[model samples]
Target chain A: MIAPFKTSYLQDMALTKTPLAKASYAGLLIALAAIPLVTGEFYVGELGGLFIFAIAGVGLMLLTGYTGLVSLGHAAFLGIGAYAHAIMLAQGVPFLVSLPLAGLITAAFGIAIGVPTLRMSGLYLAISTLAFGSIIGTVLQKWDKLTGGFDGFPVRPPTILGMKVQGAIGTYYTSLIVLVLVIWVALNILRAPLGRAMVAIRDSEISAQSMGINLAVTKSIAFGISAGITGLAGGLYAHYVRHLAPDSFDILLSIQLVTIVFIGGLGSMHGAIFGAVFMRLLPQAIAMVRDDLPFGLGRTPGLEPSLFGLILVLVIMFEPGGINGRWVKLKHWCKAFPLHRRAASRRQKSYAKSERLR
Target chain B: MESLVGLLQLVINGAATGCIYGLIALGFVLIYKATEMVNFAQGEIMMLGGFAAYTFVGKFGMNYWVGSGLAILATAAFGYLLDAVVLRRVIGQPQFAVVMLTLGLAFIFRAGAGIAWGYDSVAFVTPFTNSIVKFGSGVVLGADNLSIIFGTLVLCGVLYLFFSRTRLGIAMQASSQNQLAAYYMGIPVRRVFSLIWAISAGVAAVAAILLVPVQMVDVNSGIVGFKAFAAAVLGGFGSIPGALVGGVVVGVVEQLAGFYLPTGFQEVTSNIVLLAVLILRPQGLFGQVIRKRV
Candidate 1:
């Protein structure tokens, strides 16, 4: 049954999805493991923040991109996660134990609040989440006893294994490890029955339900998983910044996360990476421009949002599939241009023959 | 009873706030109803209108009456231009694209205003600054609040009349109800849409004019878009009366929540109200419960 193109599993020699793929993936992992060893503290610190944001973005990609749930309020979960961690650290709880607990708590909280998501879709869901986010932000400011109000609460760095882990390198490695684990979990989820169920749910809730997929459970689990991931990111953010403020979890950050998921490409892991890196780097890039540009452009902070908004709009209008999608399409077209043209002509000929038969 | 007077005041305040919400929601509904696009820019438009009016009188040395009129017209024109230049091009895109585009527009408008004007909040002086009317008991209505209530009433009344009585408004309404059917009936659907866009913009300007008196004029004033959006949802997205009721409910709830709730609970309360409404009655108070068929 093997055709010329189908030479067993050996012929399926893609860079991913095989034993060879695992080896290459492991090799890539080793290289990444060595990145902090050679990189400067400033670069590692920035990358650390980017990694944290990417983890949050991955959660969003699962929820919004894959499950088709629109949340303009994931930042609130991040805030919740951060506060959980901050509160824990303030009480002298070790960071290692607190982080996972924060994530679990966030997941539970997400499911509790996401109850409305079972019935609502689109704008209703968006508004519902947006409202929740705004409320969290306000409470973070107003709940002085717990959140420490707008000025924010201080967090001490966690000591681990009798070693004082202070500095950007430790933070970067911590963030990097978390990001790798998140990526691994996300990849596994994408491949699992639950992941396919999410995609099916996204594509058609009615069809999935008719196929005996429990809508409520699936949706709630997706929300929970997404929130847990975001919470992990949040805990990291709190520890990294060493401060937790209400303003840190405003609606704008939610929008920023949404923008990253969209611009990175919906439903693609690579897109999440692309989006996180670009979004993090873009501001710094703009800041670089500000530093280097002539006097007129100097010392301006408002330009960043405007430019960001402009890019977001442009991307939505011109590139609905995002950077990853565009890149994939480009590569595909480049690799098969000639064969695609010949096949198109052949298909047209067959179509004409079929039309005559009809 | 004095309680009756307080209830009346709450009702008055709610309705007045509802008027502003309705007007702003009218911006969302106008665009959504006609083109199936939710204009996140509506809130920013309100901010711009408020800021424009503030500047005209405060900075440009224009009279209050002139500034108010000019601000409305200018913002209406800006709305029309946005429709023509940007929104129209994005027709037939995914609803998400349209939504995010407007969201981006909101950021641009708010931040742009911030850049143009400093981040500091400024007071907007309405023409009826110091006027007050004493109710029979101790309840006194500030002239500013009274003007807002009366002005919104007049605007809404006129809008209702325009939609029902005027031919152009009727055409716009028909278009919003069903574009294909209206077009088949030989209505200039696109023109009516443009007109609605203009009218909605004008309505937002009216809301800005009314609201600026009470709230500080700043980039944050645009955040009222969500409050107004909540009002729209509470009332019913497409229903005029629903928009009014929704806005008032949101405003009064906000006020009451502010007054009675814990120090920082007002913000959370509004969202809780919205979530409750959605879970309990997603169709909203006055909205038609649409059932889709496969």
Candidate 2:
């Protein structure tokens, strides 16, 4: 790894100061920008969904990874954002205005739940969010007058200056633009004092408090920001899917979001994007190979969930560093290929501390 | 008088369902108190127990009582293996890892059961089935409901005696209080933790067996675990009696709400109660306040 030798503070804090890093990022974006023009409609739609999930994953990673607060109910936030955006559109609000409005509303929800639950331990926070998610889901279903209940809600594409933002290509570009904006915002936030405070609270709450950080305020803000970003994704999601069902936001979806933050890696931004890619592509992979498997495993009703479960269990147990960690190690290995030693870059010895006493 | 009988009957039935929830909560409390790890798969384990009982009694034509006893034993063994093989490795990891791990296991267990016993609801005949006990001239109660209550009481009494009187149970308690100290005191802390899991799984099996005459066992029956979780939190996470009491309270409230309120209220009663309890008194009714040590 190249050691940073910065002459100024701003240079050190810059998101990507190295020319190598800059060139690569610019290249990646250009490739993504080019995908819609060359790829088929099917790929555009699938990639669009990947971008949406990536948005939510980045949001969740901010909370669970940087803030050390795990949320099992993010699907509820996604649903609320989608429904709110759709409802506002139904009232003739412009699409551009409603998207950000939906995000703000979901952020309010995050802060509301965060204020109370953040006072407890992480375990309790997890449980409380689970309940909160289920409660919102039920409310959505039973309040048929607003959410349309079991019948589901239909979403109409937004018109931006007489140009209808519908179809696969439009949604793909919309989500990709939002994803880039989110990543940029997240990068800026991480370099600010609020991000430092969040990381401090995550590392050690007591020490963070001793250092004059308002634990509660910082935590709630982190949750609010995370939820707000997910809500933005949800607003985009409504246009992508064209229909919203209450059942779609159940525990399974919540678990899947957690899987993204977890399997992607806990503390890295690239992990979030990588995880979203993996999650969105897995079903397609399964579908492609459905008829070729030796056993009848492909035709099993619950095979997908079970496989997701197995992967989750295996990942947590064997590779807590996740896909991003592996990428880092591989790069390190390749850099020292001629004189590489496995022992030099092996997984660090983890010290597991008990959460019970502290 | 007839209306009073109806209310009493509802209470009785609610208490029975509550008793089942209590048993499940008790399992959660026992495991949590001992190992400090919450098992999200407790309901799935209970579902497995019911399927086991069905296999023995329904398929093999074994005697009902013997089949149930065997099922409990087998499930308890599975619980022991579950800890030694899978859960033990994740020790010292973050709490969220355990949560996700157990959740994954729950999904696996559900799919496993579905493959073994199809998705359809299934039940076998038990002694309590179709039996009714008359209470004076106005009230009638099903034997299955009575059996559930009776079974819970007997089980609790047995557990109380075992914990207070047995040496192994004392060792289990020692390990739970302080793992390092218990290890220094010649206790096998890991084995005690595994045994605690075994006891918890066994308790879940008993609940499943008692529930058979009242309701059929299916792949979806594991959703009851979520309700039991509410009960555990309501009673205080570490308190044994509190779990059972919290469960019964949630149960009765659910029944009352179903009878008096709109139809949709019943499905969400436990979750609502859970949220309410966490907001109002995070420590729970019988929980001891614990301060984190630096």
Candidate 3:
């Protein structure tokens, strides 16, 4: 293989380095845009759900993947966004206004949780977030007057400017637009110093701090942005679910979001999409084969969770780099087909040490 | 005086349940101390123990004491295999990898138990079941509650003597403190860690056996693992005595909250307490703040 000739730094550092890259990306976008027109409503709706989850997955990827913060309670942010959007829409806010507003509200909640967590990291952060999620869940459940409590809350049909987003197509287009916007923002963040700082913090918090990064402020911002993005996804999700159940945003959903970040490939935006695709497809794949199995395993109530658990364990043990990582490895292998050694550039990372280990 | 007796009964009941939580938390802390890995499936292991006891005693009509003993040994063996086969592989991975691994294992365990025992709750007759003890001045407590307290005390005492007096226990402690140094000193570090896991699981089994008369064993009974997680954190993660104290505090507070607080607050007391502890004092009551150069 030969390297591409680069005339300038601008050419060297361009997001789409080659004409082939640009063309392929454009082709992918075009395909996605035209997809709803050709596909059936069921698929379109499912894809819309995919987009919504992608948005949240990307949001969580920013925090857990890039920033190295594990949040076991991200579903709280999703709920906050959904509930906020529903409440605002119910009170006569326009769709465009309500969505961003919902994002802002959830960001505030994120900061609220994040500010207290300045001194916390890893296990403590995870545990606190778990507790925080349960607290918020209870609030959503018991706060009957506002969230409608156990009876569930209804979301009004969102109208942008003067047009109402009515069905599968509207949700599909809206969510796709949001996903694209989120990806754009996330990419821009990656290019910026902030994203570098986040990566640095993930690699070594002490080193990041020594390098003059404002640990508190940067962590808060990461939390806010991550939550805000998840909230936006939640607003999109409100449309997908129609009637909002408080229990929907739970540890399981939070785990699903983390699964997206893990299975997709940490530190890469494309992982979010790949992860979202897998997340949506697994259940469908199971459903397709549910009736054909020989044993009563087909009728097992907890099959989905166990399958998820199995996938998680397998991925961690064998493919910790996730699907995106595997894709990169495959690409590398193909590019260097004859000369590629198994040990080439396999960076061995150490475990996260507790204080005692340190 | 009557109210005092009522309060004593509540405290006693709370302590009984607290003992269970402590034992489970002890399971968590033991592994955390030994391997720097938190086993999120500790409660699930307990649930397995309960079901195994049910199979032996309830289904096969075996003697309760003997059945429970076998169940403990079985669970301990399972824990050993779990660490040897699954957990040992993730030795150098990120901390979250282990955390997620155990959580996944919890899911698999629950599903496995569901498959083996069915999803319904099961129980067996115990010596302490349905028996009550009367104190002077109209104070009465369930024999199950007394058994749990007495059993926990005896277990703790036994554990203390073993850790201090026995060479294997000392080896386990040394391995937990510094794996490399212990390995250099002729300790089979991996085997010691596995033994610690076995002991942890055995403790969980004891808790499950003690809890059988109080509550039925179901697949979801592993939900207690979350609360026990809270208990372990409250006890400062790695402190043995602190874990017990924290569990008792949480259990007593829970009982008190259920008795006095509004209907909804009862369910969230431990969560709130956990959050409060995490935010205010991350090291917990008995834990030292270990500041690393990293």
TM-score of each: 0.89, 0.97, 0.96
Which residue pairs clash within candidate 3?
none
For model 2, what is the error of residue A141's alpha carbon versus the real structure, in angstroms, after optimal superposition?
1.1
Find the candidate with the highest DockQ and give its number: 2
Model number with the top TM-score: 2
Predictions in order: lDDT: 0.80, 0.90, 0.89
Kindly list the per-residue Cα lDDT of model 3 for residues A167-272, writing each as its tens digit. 8889999999999899988888876889989999888787898999998889889989999999999998999998999888888888888888888988778898
**What lDDT tens digits, residue by residue, belong to model 2 across residues A1-358?**
2233589998867898788988999999999999988989999999999999999999999998899888989999999999999999988999889999999999999999888878877888888888889898999999999999999999988987778988989999999999999999998898899998998988888889999999989999999999999999989999889999888999999899999988999888999999999999899889999888776767778878888889889998888878987787777679878877877656556554556664
Compute the interface RMSD for each candidate structure. Answer: 10.5, 1.6, 2.2
| Model 2 misplaced stretches (Cα beyond 4 Å) | A1-12, A345-352, B292-294
Query: lDDT of model 1 at residue A198?
Result: 95
Off by over 4 Å in 3: A1-19, A345-352, A355-358, B292-294
Query: Mind giving the per-residue lDDT tens digits that candidate 3 earns over B5-102?
Result: 89999999999988999999999999999998889889899999899889999999999999999999999999999999999889887777788888
lDDT of 1 by residue, B219-260 (tens): 878877887778777776778778877777887787777766
